[model samples]
Target: MLLWRFVGRTNVILSNGVNWQRHSRVVKSALNRNVPIEKFASLTKRLFSVMGDGGRLLTFSTTLTEASRFILCLLSGTTALGHDFNTIVDNHSPFVAKYNEVMDSIASPLFLVFPKLETWFPRKHVIRKIDDLVNDFGKLLEDKKQRPGNDMLTYMLEEPEMTDEEFRDNMVVFFIAGHDTTAGAMSSFVYYLSKHPEAQVRARKEVVAALGKDEPNIENLRHMPFLQACIRESLRINTPIVSCLSLMVILSPILRAIIPDLCSNGKSYHIPAKASVIMNICAIHYNETYWPNPYKFDPTRFMNQGDGEEARIDASLWLPFALGPRQCPARNFAMYELRTLASMLLQQWEWNLPADSPHHDSIKNGFSPFALSLPKDMDIIFRRVEQ
Candidate 1:
């Protein structure tokens, strides 16, 4: 159930700083390629269908997860391996299902503390599932070898340093990295908007006014600053990636005893050399000094920048993707995806959480320490706007 089981140490995410930079360059180049806009539009339309016929009430997270997974699967497949998972049957798609199963199993407390223990007792199933997924990647790699195309797989194959194992590892990394995080972020946005109906109305107004009859292409999306603000606020309030990255946080007694100087700074600070520390993204994002009424969902805090109307805000406090050289490399792509999806959702239909739904008031109470802090549930009604 561990990430290492799925992606070995050779992958970019688990590699050292120098190796990560080298591998990241290739991966980033592939991601930076022009995205398939039309395909995304078609996928969103399909998502609408998956949501409901017209006015049916459904679980919002369920619907969003499906749509998000579908889009990611399609995009990742085509861009990474030159394959198209769009044609696959819904709910029965093996690739998507297998990935979800692995994700769910890995999020368990048992798996987190005792990753190697997955081979014993009931946990062995998780190992088998991951092996199956890796085998699937192997098959895909074989097919790509037979018919190489202009894709990430092709780019990776061209790199003499990349092993077949590493290629398989990167494929899974891309899938996991992009899929649930985006979906969770979108869900959090909608959840907040649902709780704040006035904000939702204002956001919809901004989107409609900015892009009247035009499709939500990248250019038009930029004009809707309110929508962007809402996205950022949602990211700040409920960060999907809570912990930046895994850290060892080592404080060995032997080392401390041997060298008192290494344990503490000359003043008061103390830390063993090479000890790891994880940055709590959610805490920093919610700190009072950085954000007033940190618990409230307010998008206007990000608006009217450089104008005399509001005080200049500090940008360092915001780190939804973490900071430094290893910051989330796909930040731009993630924002683009959120904007496009938000535009389409607001423009096409009116949505709101049902009064009886558990998540009507807030999703804050349901936060769990998973890969992403997803809401327990959100049931919403999506009604088509009469043309």
Candidate 2:
């Protein structure tokens, strides 16, 4: 719930790019250029190799191809837990199975109408699944700590980390934030790029140029300015998370009487003092006053070297990971995932729109209040690039 709360810190986000430098300093080991990029490149190459001639239908990659929501979840784990456990999550995690079910059963609207349902009364099925994930991973970490392995879990364990309770709490927070947020962002990236083939081509060119007959290295990905811009643009336009919801006020129950009713609205009359209220996040991204041609899909808007009024107008456009002290802690890790996957995908695969793919304007990327946008059920054809 805290992860999803609004901080109204849009203007201050990039303000602390210096602080971003500081905090990002700690996770540099995890984001170590060699391990993450190499693992991701290997994963992407292998996933594509599954699409070889005669098109032998593969299971895991097909699952990834379809359940990208889950793929993003695993990718989050890939970053958080490192490459060691990603395959375990891909093949073995029951939570992965159950999460997809919860998503399939509950569409976004019901939550929008009743955000309280998320806090007070989550679906029993979802709750069980979540509990299962937390408990299972918690135990796994504990076990690994005893074994003292070289992976991230052991690193956290032996490194004089938090108490057991704190570890468990952090895991709960970590898993949810790490998984849900990345899934949300990647879905948007895939969906938007799918819609805009020109941008996709540009991304492909950037990646191929960077990966020229060699594995993607951190240096190459860092230098791919156009691809990074595309990811940033995708994130800007299709901010997977819209806004954090909050009850109008946080008055204690004992002193609640004098509070104005916020929930009275849609009650056919006055709203109650303490009803749940959603912050309008997409409004910030799409604001016409701030953004020129707000409705137009353009990533170049972020990089435009406009002078006079235009550059001033372009300053504040997007933050899908969110803003403020409450902004995502795993942002560095997320960049690793987005850039690495993008680099490898572009380097190895050639994507073409599936037949009958809808136009960008016609496609309706689903939005679940907090989830800014969702990837529609779109099939992308991928063939290995000929050397």
Per-prediction TM-score: 0.84, 0.69
Candidate 1 deviation (Cα RMSD): 4.8
Q: Write the per-residue lDDT of candidate 1 for residues 13-131, one digit (tens) a residue.
A: 77766788877877677667765555556656676775556654444434544555566666657655777776324656768778878877767876568756666655667778988
lDDT for model 1: 0.71
Listed per model in order, the count of residue pairs whose N, CA or C atoms clash below 3 Å is: 0, 13
Q: How accurate is candidate 2 locally (lDDT)?
A: 0.55
Clash pairs detected, candidate 1: none
**Per-residue error at 41 for model 2, in Å?**
2.4
Summing lDDT over every window of 10 consecutive residues in candidate 1, give the lowest-scoring window.
262-271
* Model 1 misplacement above 4 A: 51-67, 78-81, 87-89, 114-116, 119-123, 147-161, 247-268, 305-313, 364-370
The most accurate candidate by lDDT is 1
